[model samples]
Target chain A: MRSILNITDLSLEELDQLIATAEDMIADPKKYSEVCRGKKLATLFFEPSTRTRLSFEAAMLELGGSVLGFSEASSSSAAKGESVADTTRVVGCYADIIAMRHPKEGAPVVAARKAGVPVINAGDGGHNHPTQTLADLLTIWRNRHTFEGLTIGMCGDLKFGRTVHSLVGAMARYAGVKFVFISPEELKIPQYVITDELEPRNIPYKEVTTMEEVMPELDVLYMTRVQGERFFNEADYIRLRDTYILTPEKLTTAKEDLIIMHPLPRVNEISVKVDDDPRACYFQQVLNGKFMRAALIMKLLEVNV
Target chain B: MIIGQIKDGIVLDHITAGRGMDIYKILELDKLDCTVALIERAVSPKMGRKDIIKIDQAMDIDFDVLGYIDPGITVNTIRDGEVVERRQMALPERVVGVLKCKNPRCITSVEQELTQEFKLTDRKNQVYRCIYCDHKASK
Candidate 1:
């Protein structure tokens, strides 16, 4: 069975089709509500998640499917020393599909290997969150109309942000896509991403310390939270956390059509005042997540709607 | 000075100098009942000085593990004191259960049954990343 363990697992054609399907779901929600009727979705969230977990649960509910499984590891068989493979194997027996979120990277990959049903990596520790990429893609597709010839600016902690990593890997596949990586020297996008994904693909990209330097050129500004927990030194985190805060002043320098995005649960990185701006699409991104997830679940389960 | 020739076994030749012990330890050569000789700092025309491992027993060897550890290694099969087969080794496209992924958050670390698998992502840079977590294997 096919599993979306990484964003790159989906070809550009499949991504386009998924995005199109998501748009269709948004256009006519009532028609697709019963697409996944009688299907069982197992949401195995081994990590605490508000938006991602709820989005998966909401997607299944909206699709007329039943949702089962845990919101955290402590409540599941995992707390009793059950392995991910065993848990997925057992859950697969009951559920038609599985959406897993884990603190450990590759936990969903392990689940996918043993699972009888299709496994979706909801979020894994600083590794990958392919569905989030799909949501981001859908959001971008709705706003920008196309992925090509766009300057996507990724700000804040690029190094540890799995969303940024997955998004970059996804967007790089499109033609004429340029990246502006804005981060502190310590938190710059990993070299492997440049070497493995961009360089070989010949995607033009520039690295800058300040967001202001690249704001005007960006078509899409992807913002990520710089958590104190990700830093070795508390002082460094404190110093960098405020470095790229997207204030009203910063938004003025950006393009009028620039799409401001954040993988939310925001902590001061994006000012709440910026939420009122017409360009801020993070909230819409959350809704798009539900639709895209519905599309993903339908596609994975082979439900034609 | 030439070492004792093996009658029928396998010979790991042209290992980078000082890496024989690492390869030996990794392969657990000492546990084998047959004679296993590690010749460290052996003279090499191409490499100047290299290591060689001569196992005096025919057994299936993990070439991927050998290739991962040292890509420049040459494996030779000895049949009746004659070198019947000689093959040069290169890094394996994928390695399983050989090198442990150091990433604490990798699934292999938490799930004991999961094999520590890595794929050679960058051959020019000699970069191997864990297949599950994509954590680069440290040299």
Candidate 2:
């Protein structure tokens, strides 16, 4: 069965196709409403994520499919110590497709291995989050209309930012894409990302401590929050949480059409004042997430309007 | 120093000087019932210094552990005190139940029954990542 455990699972063509489908969905929502009429989506979230869980549930609902499964581990059989493999196997018997989010990395991979139906990894610890990358991709595509020759400056915690990692991995596949990593020394992008993704592809990228230095050069400024949950040391999280804040002052040198994005659930990493700016596409990213997810669900289910 | 030739077993040669003990410990050579000899810092013409291991019984060996620890090491199968076949090691694409994922956030840490697996992601760098968490394996 096909499962999206990582963003790399989808090729560049598939990404463009998904983007095209999402755009078409936006233009004609009623045309695809009943595509997944009899399908059932099981959202197996072992972690608490209101946004991602609801997004999947809403996507299934909007596609005329019913949604089942629990919101958190506590509400599921996982709390009673049932394995993800067994749970997925049981849920596969009920749901046509599965969207799983777990606190442990590779839990969805285990589920995908055991599950007979298609599996979608919503979020897997600090590891892969393919769907979030899909949302970011669609948002970037809609705004810029191209991934080529775009300089993306990713700021804040890149070390544990799974979304940033996934996006970088996805974007590196495109030609003429450059990355400017803006983060504190402690939370810089991992070496594997540099070695495995950038260096191998000969993709041009630079790491900088200050975002202001690279602000004017970026066509896309992807801001990520320094999540406290990802940090083992509370003091370290506190120190780096406010390291890079995107304010209106920071945008003075940025391009007028520069698209600013966040994965949402922001905590002071992006100021509220910047939300009114025409370039702030984070909220639109959320709405695009639903559409992209709907397109993904349809593609995985092999449903046609 | 000279070690006796095994009538039937295997000979491990050309291990990097200091990593013999690591290979020995990881392979649990001490648990073997048959006679085993570890020659560390042995004189070698090819290598400035090397380590060699001799086993007295023909038994199943975990080649993944051997390949992971020292891919350059040579393995010679012995029969009737004669070298029958020689093998050169390469990093296996995937190894299972050999190394554990140390990352606490890995699903294998909680799911004890799950097999601990690692994939050789970077051959140039000799980097193996835990298949579950993508955490780089530290040698």
Candidate 3:
């Protein structure tokens, strides 16, 4: 009867339950693999996202459930003028659970209103991507083995990065979490997020132009890429872009136990040279995403597989 | 300028003055064959200048249509030339079909037959965005 529209929709209790389930799945994958054997997950991605789409499909498939629905918007009935409400209603008939990723802000809200089954917002523009937040939560929990009293540095493209927003919202719920926002002036984290989520909650945070200054003090370094097209001033973009590139030299400044994560499809943001570090957890984050998603699919559908 | 009122009909008041014409055209008050009188720039302290729409027939207006008319207007029901029920009709929490989404690339904006829906996110900002395209319809 409920939908995963935003991170706030999941209460602290529900989030704890989801995180616990994800940890259980991660601990023993085979034991939970067949919990959704008879079910189906309909992924209606209005915006084409190969990684997120594949993650949802992989989660469902590994759970022994089948995947259906369109990866691209044009491939679906949405191309021929079908509203999200109508599409969800129609797709809900064929699938047990629905996951939608739209370029629009509230497309999933429309889907949730009319969907006969549970709806999950895979990603909806720069507005929200709650499931990714779930993955990040599980990853941070598993890597650090705790959620509190960490200097979390969110570096690069914080302005329009929905992942950063979701993460900030999620982490703000935890105790003694300080945030260091590292980004170029133009790509500084949106004020709405800072004022609305951080300042009001009295979560201590500071803005920094360089990662090295805060990198040494950080326990978690979450990196994001700066797409060339996102910036109107090409010169500023080029200048600051190189500064955020994580090389092996950067790790010398970071704590040995520091966990680095990127919501992948990264382009030169974190050099491949840094991937060898034991603290690099982006790949592990990907696997954790699958486990978290599998946990979500099973829980939402009330299936064991 | 004495403009008459309608009995047992809806009177939309405090319309930020000149927007009454836009609402007349948007609601297509002419086609309804309802006796409609539009007054612009009538002085008032609340709206400074106000526009009032007196509809002869009692018909439930789409809240989206009401908001599209003017973000500031309050829809009031009239009976026997007296105010019976008056409430500011909000651009509902969720809008089905009223205004065209401005984004050319959005699926809803491109589809000619689609019923455009916009979930009003920033109520205080008076921001009503397209659910299909994330486009804001600004006046």
User: What lDDT does each candidate get?
Assistant: 0.91, 0.93, 0.82
Expressed as tens digits, the lDDT of each residue in B1-139 for candidate 1 is 7689889999999999999999999888899999999999988999999999999999888998888889999999999999999989988999987788998878888787778889999998889999889999986
Question: In model 2, where do residues sit more than 4 Å from their true spots?
Answer: none
Native-structure RMSD, model 3: 4.3
- Order of candidates by DockQ, top first? 2, 1, 3
Q: In order, how many clashes per candidate?
A: 0, 0, 4
Worst-scoring 10-residue span by lDDT in model 1 chain A: A227-236
Q: lDDT tens string, model 2, B35-95?
A: 9999999989999999998888897877888898899999999999899999998898988
Q: Model 1 segments beyond 4 Å from truth?
A: A228-236
Give the higher-DockQ candidate: 2 or 3: 2
DockQ of each: 0.83, 0.83, 0.20
TM-score of each: 0.95, 0.97, 0.78
In terms of lDDT, model 3 sits at 0.82
lDDT of 2 by residue, A20-103 (tens): 999999999988888899999999999999999999998889889999999989999998989999999999999999999999
**lDDT per residue, candidate 1, A1-305, as tens digits?**
78999999999989988998988888888988888889999999988897898999999999999999999999999999998888999999999999999988888888998998999999899889999999899999999898899999999999989999999999999899999999989899999899999999899999999998888899999999997765668998888888788899988888999999998878999999999999999998999999999999999999997
Error of 1 at B108 (Å): 2.5
